[model samples]
Target chain A: GDSVTQTEGLVTLTEGLPVMLNCTYQSTYSPFLFWYVQHLNEAPKLLLKSFTDNKRPEHQGFHATLHKSSSSFHLQKSSAQLSDSALYYCALSGEGSNAKLTFGKGTKLSVKS
Target chain B: NAGVIQTPRHKVTGKGQEATLWCEPISGHSAVFWYRQTIVQGLEFLTYFRNQAPIDDSGMPKERFSAQMPNQSHSTLKIQSTQPQDSAVYLCASSRGHERLFFGHGTKLSVL
Candidate 1:
C-alpha cells in the first residue's frame, strides 16, 4: 500500500515570510510526487509535480523537490503572499496498482498582512 | 477546456435513499478518479477508471458503493441506501498522459 503524510495541519505566516509545508510518502515503487493547492471555493489545481528528472518543479513561485532517497517532497516558497492562503495537498502515484494518486490529509495555510 | 465537470454541485438526500454523482472527464484524458473529502478525512481516494474500464476499485466500499465509466467522456459514482456518514464532498479528477490531475469543483453530498 501507498500513503502520504503531511505533518502540519495548519501553517500561518505573515506576508513576505518564507513558507514550508512538510510532505513525506511511503511507496513500494518509483514515486511520482505532486503538490496541489485549493483556493477558498475553487477546485484543487496542480501546483507542481516531480518525476525522475529531479528538476525541482516550480509554479506560482512555489517549488518542491522529490527526494527518492528520503521519500519526501516538501513544498517551499521563498516569500509568502495572501493569495497563497489555501489548502495544500501532497500526493503520490506509481506502479503496481491503477497508478492513482494517494493524497495526504492536507495542510491549511493562512497568510496575514 | 472545461477541466473536469461534476454535476449537482450540492446534493441532499434522506437516509437510506440512493444518490448518484456524475463526473465528466476531459475530452482526451484516459483516466478518471473519484475521491471523497471531509473535515475529518481531508481527501480519500474512492475509485478510478482508465480507458473506460475499471482498473482499480480497491478503494471503494464493496456493498453500497459502485462506479461506472461506460464511455470516455463520463463516469458516475452511485451510493445505495446512503447513510449520514456518507456526507462529504465528492471530487472527480482526470489526467491525460501524466499524474498531474485536474479536478472539478466537487459535489457536496449531505445525507440526513
Candidate 2:
C-alpha cells in the first residue's frame, strides 16, 4: 500500500515571506512523488515531480527535494506572493506504467498582502 | 492539446437513480485515471485504464460502482442506485508513459 501525509491543513503567510508545506510518504515500492496545485474553482495541475536521478524538481519558483531516507519531499518557496493561495496535494506513484497515484489530504495555502 | 475532457461539468441525481460519467483522455496518452474529490474524503482514486484496458479498480465500491474503457479515447464511470454520500467531483486525468498527469475540469456529481 502507498500513502501520502501532509501535516499542514492550512498555511498562512504574508507576501515576500518564505513558505514550506510539509509532505511525507510511505510506499512498498520505489516511489514517484508529485506535487499538484489547485486554485479556486480550477482543476488541479502538476506543480512538480521527483526525478529518479535525484535532481530537485522545481516549478514556478517553488522547489522540492525528494529525500528517500526521510520519506519527505517538502515544497518550499523563498518569497510567497498573493497569487500563491491555493490547495496543495502531495501524491505518490509506484514503479511501472500501470501504477495509480495515492494523494494526501491537501494543504490550503493562503498568502496575504 | 485540449487536455483531458470530462463531459457535463455538473450532474444531479436523486437517490436510487443511476448516473453515468464520461471521460475523454488526451490523444496519444496510454493511461486514464478517475478520482473523486470531496470535502471530507479529499481526493480518492477510483480506477484507471492503461492501454485501453482495466488495470486496477481496488478503490471502487464493488457493488454499485463500475468503470470501463472500451477504447483508448474514452471511458465511463457508472454508479447505480446513487446515494447522497456518493456526491463528489469526479475528475479524469490522462498521462503518457506514466509521466505527468493532466486533469480535466471534472464533473461535479450531486446526489440529492
Candidate 3:
C-alpha cells in the first residue's frame, strides 16, 4: 500500500516570509511525487512534480525536492504571497500501470499581509 | 481548453437514493480519473480509465459504487443507496501518458 503524510495541519505566515510545508510518503516501490494546490472555491491543480531528470520541480515560485532517502518532497518558497493561501496536498502514485494517486490529509496555508 | 467538465456542480439526495455523476474529459486525453474530496479525508482516489478502458478501481466501494467509461469523451460514476458517509466533492481529472492531471470544478454530492 502507498500513503502520504503531511505533518502540518495549518501553516500561517506573513507575506514575504519563507514558506515550507512538510510532506513524506511510504510506498512499496519508488513512486512519483506530486504537489497540488487548491484555492478557495476552485479545483485542485498540479503545483509541482518529481521528474526523472532529478531537477527540482518549480512552479509559481514554489519548489520541491524529492528525496528518496528521506521519502520527503517538502514544498518550499522563499517568499509567500497573499494568493498562496490555499489547501496544499502531497500525493504519490506507485509504479506500474496504476495512475491513481494516494494523497495526504492536506495542509492549509494562510499567508496574510 | 476546457480542462475537465463535471455536470451538476452540486447534487443533494436523500439517504438510500441513487446519485449519478458525469464527467467529460479533455479532448485527446487518454486517461480519466475519479476522486472524492472531503474535509475529513482530503482527496481519495476512486477509479480511472485509459483509452476508454478500465484500468483500476480499487478505491471504489464494492457494493454501492460503480463506474463506467463507455466512450473516450465522457464517463459516469454511480452510487446506489447513498449514505451520509458518501457526501463529498467528486472530481474528474484527465491526463496524457500519466502526466500532470487537469481537474474539473467537481460535483459536490450531499446525501442527507
lDDT of 1 by residue, A1-113 (tens): 89999999999999999999999999888878888899999999989889677888888899988888899999999999999999999998857546688899999999999
Candidate 2 CAPRI assessment class: medium
Error of 3 at B90 (Å): 0.5
- Over B76-105, each residue of candidate 3 has an lDDT whose tens digit, in order, gives 999999999999999999998568889999
- Give the per-residue lDDT digits (tens) of candidate 2, residues B9-108: 9999999999999999999999899999986667899999889888889899999999999989899999999999999999999988578888999999
Query: What is candidate 2's TM-score against the reference?
Result: 0.97
List ranges where model 2 is wrong by over 4 Å.
none
Q: Chain A in model 3: its TM-score?
A: 0.98
In candidate 1, the residue pairs with backbone N, CA or C atoms under 3 Å apart (3 or more residues apart, or in different chains) clash, namely: none
Number of the candidate with higher DockQ, 2 or 3: 3
Off by over 4 Å in 1: none
- Residue-pair clashes per candidate, as listed? 0, 0, 0
lDDT (Cα, tens digit) per residue for candidate 1, span B1-112: 8779999999999999999999999998988999999867788999988898887888898999999998898999999999999999999999874567889999999999
Summing lDDT over every window of 10 consecutive residues in candidate 1 chain A, give the lowest-scoring window: A92-101
Pairs in steric clash, model 3? none
Q: Report the TM-score of candidate 1, chain B only.
A: 0.97
Sort all candidates by lDDT, best to worst: 3, 2, 1
| Candidate 3 ranges beyond 4 A from true positions | none
